[model samples]
Target: MNRTIAIGDIHGGLKALIQLLKRIDLSPNDKLIFLGDYVDGWSDSANTITYLIELAKQNTCVFIRGNHDDLTEAWLRTGDLNEQWLQHGGQSSIDAYRNFTSEEIKEHLAFFKQMVNYYVDKENRLFVHAGFTNIRGVENEYHDTAFYWDRTLWEMALSLDDKIPTDHKFYPKRLLLFREIFIGHTPVTRIGEDKPVNMANVWNTDTGAAFKGKISAIEIKTKEIWQSDPVHELYPDEDGRN
Candidate 1:
């Protein structure tokens, strides 16, 4: 089978991303799918985005929009925004783009907007920035807020016994799609430890690269996992202060 590598939240760890790619030994036939959160957190969001854009130009790179990316796009457009972004590692992104001119910012925004909400294959595997909610008849509604920022869904999915509740009056069915959903939000302390209650689905990544945790990537078909050591630390004083 063709190799498909799914990388978790990068959070501006450009060096780690590059290192992880080198460790993986990617081939021309392999595909790399980034699980979003490309910017923010670490000190190299701008460089990270530039590298990803260049990589996409050369390889079969699939980008998914994360909550941070959404806020960055919003900040780029309005220049007026809330503090949540800064608190959650958006400062690095701000710092990264500080040197860029207006034209460069516009170009970056164009690339960011081009990211897809999710990447699905013919097999039972699905890659999304965040877990999806079974809203109404839709399997994954792909709500921008939920897709990028929501943790409640992650908690609910993690806590469920066997079936995901669709009691929002939006979804009548108790269970959504039967395929396994691979997500990146709600960072786990250990990789591959969290397992879905109902099915073979798994939230096998997001080891918290922004909070002094490892960065993870996994092979879709082989279930091979790789991680990088924590590169930076987040102080408690930095919390909620941006």
Candidate 2:
């Protein structure tokens, strides 16, 4: 049977990404769902994008767009860098592309343009870079930023009781609308761990691989997980997210 895997924000941790895939023993038959932020934070963003571009040729890959990805795409297309993008690890990705030609930049921009904001599989599993406010109408959300920047949904999930609230339930239980929701923009490292964290029916796969943690991937059906070494160890000389 083909494996269904969901990976978290890569943040240019190519080494961590390689190790995570190796740990999971990912194959061509695997349905690879990559939560975004593929570039930014660490060095080697170009290599990371190149590797994923190649990996897509060999596997069933779904790429979701994260906020960082949007910024990078915008800059590549128009050479416009906003203060926010530059402050939040955008320089790292820019430096990573110091050797690229105009054609290569355009190619990379095209790849980013192809990325979707959110993807729902046949099983009703929602895979997104960040949070979505309306589960039912996720595709037509008014605010695109919510897909790559929202954290309220996770906060809701985290604040709720583990068991289905039989008494007074939260006004809007977003997790109840799907089989499961998988997200990546918010790093689990903030909660004091460098691994995937499950809260209610939502799974946070980002482990801060761009900073002090590692990259992660989880099998959707089996709940099996794979992680890389600390991202710092992978790029000791570089100050990630600096």
Candidate 3:
């Protein structure tokens, strides 16, 4: 069987990603699809992106653009952005660029722009950084905010009840299509776990790598999920749960 592995949000957890990859025993024949947010929240954003780019060049890797990636790319392009990025783990991303020269930054930004918004297979399996509002519109037709930052879309896509339509506008009854969408943005308790709503056909791969969770990846064909534990010390907990 062809093995295509879709990785969850890395959040700059290069060590954890590497560990999970080893555990999966990835091979040249296997395809790896990264759902985005490759940088931020950890200490190795630069290294993570660099390695992922290299992987894209040499191996079967599909890199999708995440919300955080869009923000970082904006900073890299315009050299100025809102302070909201800092509150949402942008400080670590900024630190990642400290060592790179202006030329290198430009190169990275260009690479970021080239990333595809989504990936789809003939089997109706869609891979997007975040869920889409309407699946009927032309691909990549939605705004960047909807592509990366829209939480409502995610909620709607993951809603189990069929009462929530995939598209706001109705199309031909024969054209009604429900493709299984694989996404990463909202971190769930674990990877590969189906959402509460079963009708959405959404798979959340973010295992809270930046928080108190692990990094995760899942095989598209087999639905085999793999994860790596946190490599660093955890923040002190006032509740004494640690």
- Report every candidate's CA lDDT: 0.71, 0.87, 0.71
Model 1 RMSD, rounded to 1 decimal: 4.7
Alpha-carbon deviation at 16 in model 3, angstroms: 0.9
Backbone clash pairs for candidate 1 read 136-170, 136-171
- Cα lDDT for residue 202, model 2? 89
Clashes of each: 2, 0, 0
TM-score of each: 0.82, 0.95, 0.82
Per-residue lDDT of model 2, residues 10-102, tens digit only: 899998899888899878889999999999988889888889888999999999999999998888878887898888889998999999988
Question: Which scores better on lDDT, 1 or 2?
Answer: 2
Task: Tell me the lDDT of candidate 2.
Answer: 0.87
Indicate the worst ten consecutive residues by lDDT in candidate 3.
233-242
**Model 1 residue 150 lDDT score:** 60
At residue 194, give the lDDT of candidate 2. Answer: 80
Among these predictions, the greatest lDDT belongs to: 2
- TM-score of model 3 (CA atoms): 0.82
**Which residue segments of model 1 deviate by more than 4 Å?**
135-142, 162-176, 190-200, 233-242
Cα-based RMSD of candidate 2: 1.5
